[model samples]
Target: MLRWLTRSLHRKLTFVLVIATMVPVILLGMVSYHTASTITEEKAKLTGVNTLRQVNAIIETMVLDVENMSVFLIGQQEVQSYLTRERSGASEYLRMIGFLTNLAFSKPYISDIRIIPFNGNAELTNTTILQSTLFQQVDTDPQFWKNNTKWWSPPLTTVTSSGIKQTVSLVRPIRDMNTFKTIGMLSIGIDTAVIAQRLRDAAVDGAVMLVQDAQGRTIAASSTSITPSFVKIVTDKMTNSHETERLNSVGEGEDNQVVITAPVPIVPWDAYLAIPHHTFSAQNRYVLQLTAIAVVLAVVIMACAVGYFVRQVTKPLIRLARHLPAVSLERAYRPLPVESEDEIGTLISSYNLLNENIRQLTEQVKQNEAAKIEADLQALQAQIQPHFLYNTLSSVQWMAWMSSNDQIANMVGALGDFLRFSLNRGMQMCTVQQELEHIRNYLYIQSIRYPDRFTVETYFPDELMGNQMLKLLLQPLVENSIIHGLLKTKADQRGLLTIEAETPEPGWIRLRVCDNGVGMTEMELHALRERLAHYRFDDKAALHAPVGQDTSGCSAQMKPLGGYGLYNVQKRLLLHYGERAQLHVDSKQGAGTVITLYLMSNWTESQLNAS
Candidate 1:
């Protein structure tokens, strides 16, 4: 009877110990799996949110930079000076070009900077070295000027003059400051690879980065297979939900995975993160294994009267389960008071330390953000200096006129007109008539300074009088003749400058500028043709040399003009008219030089007959 009672007591104790050990292991496993899964999912969501925010901030900064650049250009006294003197000296025009080139170099992202006068000429007034290599593209593309909107385009393959290929362009139309007309477009090429690298850097582990167009075509991607179907899926997910959600999908070996989609929010684009189900499921696997081991141990330990040991292990786990809600809610989690110094106590202490580290990291992130803002402000200030110089030049021109030196007065007057036209007062387009008048003013002033050195005669058919041309078209060529061709001739040689516009056929107006002065050598002619063919501006050193070096004679009275003026004229014309208008230059040593411009006749049958 005594032996049976002891056996019954032992059996009861064994069952109770087994239940105590197994129950906590089962419960802790569920609780631990839930806690870890929740933390990981929350972290991924936070990462997606933070990434979207950063992309937004980057795009905003870029937009602000573009706007600031536009405003700086519009407010530039040099643009006004260039436009004001559009009818005057090549020197004034060159000055404007120099200013523009400097601005282009200051920004690495700015592929090119140009001032297209409303004249019917394609000339490059000012350009970066890289832009000088791509003049042909600007000169041949009429859509560049006709398009009125500001936007970025997909990667466009284009060959440089030297025959190198590049991609993607950002274009913004520059308007006439006074009339608000679209005069020319400013194009900047983005290094797509660099942008891709930036996106890659922003991506978190398991995250996919993508850039898409409005049509949902992926233009660029990082660490993701960017297919049309994938873009469509991402686009649909982003459109359907404002809050990001994790979707279940089959993974390798039939395992489950979670897909989290987020909108990039810079342009219309989407990003995704995938977390495999195994990551979450693994957390519970260890607990199940421990429960099996604990069951067997409980049976043996209970037989030895070790029920108190089972309770000691299970109690700590129960306390840990109670503390989970606090940790999840970001509240302080204090472990329950423990009398025993064991591994379980060490885990609680480590968790508290981790929470403290996260808090410190968050504070540091806030401080770094403040520093970025200050750096951006400094960049803005650096961009404003050139505009100030332009304004000062204007005041100086006015003072020169008041001094009663007509030569200086005329030069200053021409300078003012050229600046004004270059400035465009913000307009994008102007009539050919306006452009011609501007050029006439420029020539008149040059003729004043070198009355005996150059003569200009214009022959235009009455029918083509109303035709429109881009602004500042003729000024550069006229300036070029004076500075490069005519000025180079000996005084004994007659510097004859002739301009004629006639319609041999009903639909065409051919304008010509023929000069009887020093002609170009093969090398010089090749360089000239290459420059015009490529639409490149001359080097600043070349543009600023003594008049004789760029031209024909060493005279103290020779005007100081930059070579970029002619380049600007050619670029503006080609951008507006396409192949319908072109520049042609013919020169023979000691014989003379002639430049003929071909354009479409802006005349109706009635108008032609009436004239």
Candidate 2:
């Protein structure tokens, strides 16, 4: 086979192409089969767990009703007197039996009620005329009491006038309400048929609902498939197992099933909802079969397409080998058709990429010139203010030293530091700590300028100092908050401004400036956020962006975002960081405003130049 393919390039290439297509399709089918099986089983397990929880809740509600009734009976005056009285005669217990009868008739699920006296008196079922015994089978765990009532018993068989019935009994030690002493014990029998009704709703497709007591005895079940033998198999496999609320498979002869088990809330019993694995996977099987058919069809279609494509690809090579194709810069640079993923195809792709790079580099050159013009204008305007501030602060520092005033001296030193950081015209960006220190110096000056009018809070992480962002963004936002937000508050109210730096997610830094002062109305906020969303890397707008006046040219009614406002910061962000930068503003009238910036971490000078 290798020699026949090597005799000609066409056969070898066709063989290679066919093998590549066939191998991936076969491998993908295998992976899809395994993945689909795993996903189907997981979905089945989740469904089973939810169904069991619903069934357990219903059973808990029934048990709670029984416990509530026992609480009322334990506190009854007549029943408390019968258990604690000095009189031991038969007539004294006669009226106590009447109270038990009235309690049993109230709830329809209650089959019978028993009051077992601890002093060895006959247990009263209905009246003193008949007696019963139940405690000899159960030693009450006092630690499990619901106030005066003890925890319920497992299901038990009882014969009444109607027939033999399964009943789950609730036992309570009657207490004297005043002394809180155990007077006597009472037992309430609940029919298990009501439990079967609750289980019916939990039945999944081809599912059986079987409940077992704490001792792994099947007490209540509601399916025809459940026999004594099957119940034992499920209980044996599931009872000692430590799995909680998850479906596990049980193999029993010809029957294979998956079950989800949940403990009944009030009683120490487990409820099992077993569904056949076959029934759960029936739809999954249909999908797998359909996938097999699709894979076969895909393989057939791939062969036909590859046959015609390779022929066309070979003809192009045969024609090109005779003489090179003519090339000229005047011809439009549209992409040549991709015939096949081969050696020739890679050559074509590289050629296309080179053309794309050339086109992009030319466009980038134009954008760079526009940005340089903008930067020079900004630097010219920026140089004037910082030198003026620095010179004034130097004079104040000398005056404060002569007067021996430490507060005025500290304010002058902060102003000097702020000016020193702000006057870096050679660098367009700075580390996060540099920007934070700049803001702190500015805020300190503002605090000294308006001492009792407002307060400032700042949070900057030390670890984030290594990350870099555009300089002047944070200070401008902080100044806007102080002027438009904080200082505009009512006379009686104090103002607060919070500035924070944190990482909202990995590889992303978030800068937030918040104020608790007069905020923007809805209309103003909407117009501002809409304005920010429309800004892209607009070369013309950024180049001609007026430094001394607001030339944003969008709306006269809206605030001009030329020099320094919330929207101006966003335009700067888009100019340098491209789509990796985002600015969002939220405000409500009379409440406050919050400005948030999301930027990629560790931004570099190359990114600004490219943008």
Candidate 3:
């Protein structure tokens, strides 16, 4: 489904445009929302913390007032003697009620007070009904009777004619003023409405207010709207740090809560205000809605633009395609009219330009074909004359033989064989044996010309002579030795040139041409080697096409740009065989020069036999 939606230029472009419009809007909204949310959260935390602290102070002050009142009542000489009395009359009991009533009514936070005596005397109370159930439950309640070191007791639940309610008490054992002995207990019930009202007043929106004892037990929570799981989480997070924390506490299900714990004075109870995380994000709702609206509007705008663009692009091509069936390609191109200066117009102009170039090329191809046919006929006529030269050479040899001149007959035969091998059907590579044979014929002619000027020797093994290599590779080296080395020797010196072939390794061959002629000096050898190194890079080192061939019954030599010497040999070896083929020229001034060519042997037995 996703691939199908993004398959076309229109849909993809729509997505791109919408995203381009929406990214900065969304980013700015997010950054603004985050900054505002942070500031608001801190403010909420401060307000919550301050409210909890004030509520804690109120509870602490109420506890202190109750404790001091209880002490003052117990320490009164008349009340102490009355509480310890073994027999108390109606006047004393009624008078004791007045003392307890005045102490209870002294503080506004004290709702109800009681004095239960161990001695056989009637209990004093402020209410006329004198609820006996409260007395019985307070006497029997397990949690209510727990030992406490603080001046005030932890919050305890009690049942009255009203519904269940929570309250703190200053429940202390009253001591006799004379002996410092404990009497019956005096419990001052703190006003439950006052504490509850305080909790409600401090309650921030979406905050679950709680009152906990010093033992970290939940005494009363102001909110029943909270889930039982969240209440459990708040109670479980007993942070020692006085500051509020985003306590990600308890067992994992919705455990995150912001718990602000403030220590209540005197009693050491803690007042906790737990605000849920959802409440903190209430401020970002407006920003998020605005961003979403902007994205939707951008998407709508993008849809209109992309649809219009795609229609404009595809309409022209559709119109052009409709005309294609009627269009025809003729010898001369007739241009289609350009309707508008858009890409479609350029496309029509390109089509007309291509058709014109194609028409011209068609005419050129026809002319080339005609010229090729005429040249083929001329080539056929020329083919008849090649054998004429061979026939003439054969006739000359026969004439020399008829006249009994064996030297002329032998020379003519050698010349004919040499010319035949040199133009061996235009094959660039020849066998080692055939190449050495060509060299032998050339040396015979040279020996006749300068009989005592030079001497030539050859060493070729039958095993290595059948290997195939580049044709005429050795001829240039031999020619260079004769022309530049051997022919330039001292008059007293008879130049001796040696030609040899060897196999240094399997599948590799080396051909050597050494001459005992006037060798080059150090500087001359350096200059020649530098020229050979840069032969391929030198523009003048390029081998030129021959202008014409000399067909006077002699072997034709092709003069390359750098002359057909060691430079030609180096260039040919590199061009044909790459770096593996090597040409090394070793020479000592006035002593000798050795030119060795190393190339791979690349022919099978059939190829050698064919050569």
Q: Candidate 1 lDDT (Cα, whole model)?
A: 0.58
TM-score of 2: 0.39
Which is the leading candidate under lDDT?
2
lDDT scores in order:
0.58, 0.76, 0.71
Misplaced by over 4 Å in model 3 are: 1-12, 84-86, 102-109, 128-151, 157-165, 191-194, 225-231, 239-255, 283-611
- On a 0 to 100 scale, what is the lDDT of residue 281 in model 1? 36
Residue-level lDDT of model 2, residues 35-69, one tens digit each, is: 77777777777877888888888888878888888
Best by TM-score: 3
Using Cα atoms with residue i matched to residue i, what is each candidate's TM-score against the true structure?
0.36, 0.39, 0.43
- Output the TM-score of candidate 1: 0.36
Q: Candidate 3's residue-wise lDDT over 1-611, tens digit each?
A: 68976665556665676677667756765676677678767777777778877787777777777777777777777767777988889998888888767766777666667777778777776645323344444444334345542245556665544445556666666767767566677777775656766788778887778776766655556765656566667767666544443333234435456777776766656677877666776745675566567656766676677668766766666556555554443445566777889888998778768767777887788899999999999998698665787899999999999999988888898999888887788677789999999999888888777778888889998998777888878888888888778888776779899999889999899899999888888887876676566544334324232322222221233233334566667766665665678898889877889999998897543553343
Off by over 4 Å in 2: 1-30, 82-108, 117-136, 139-151, 178-183, 237-247, 252-254, 283-611
Per-residue lDDT of 554 in model 3: 19
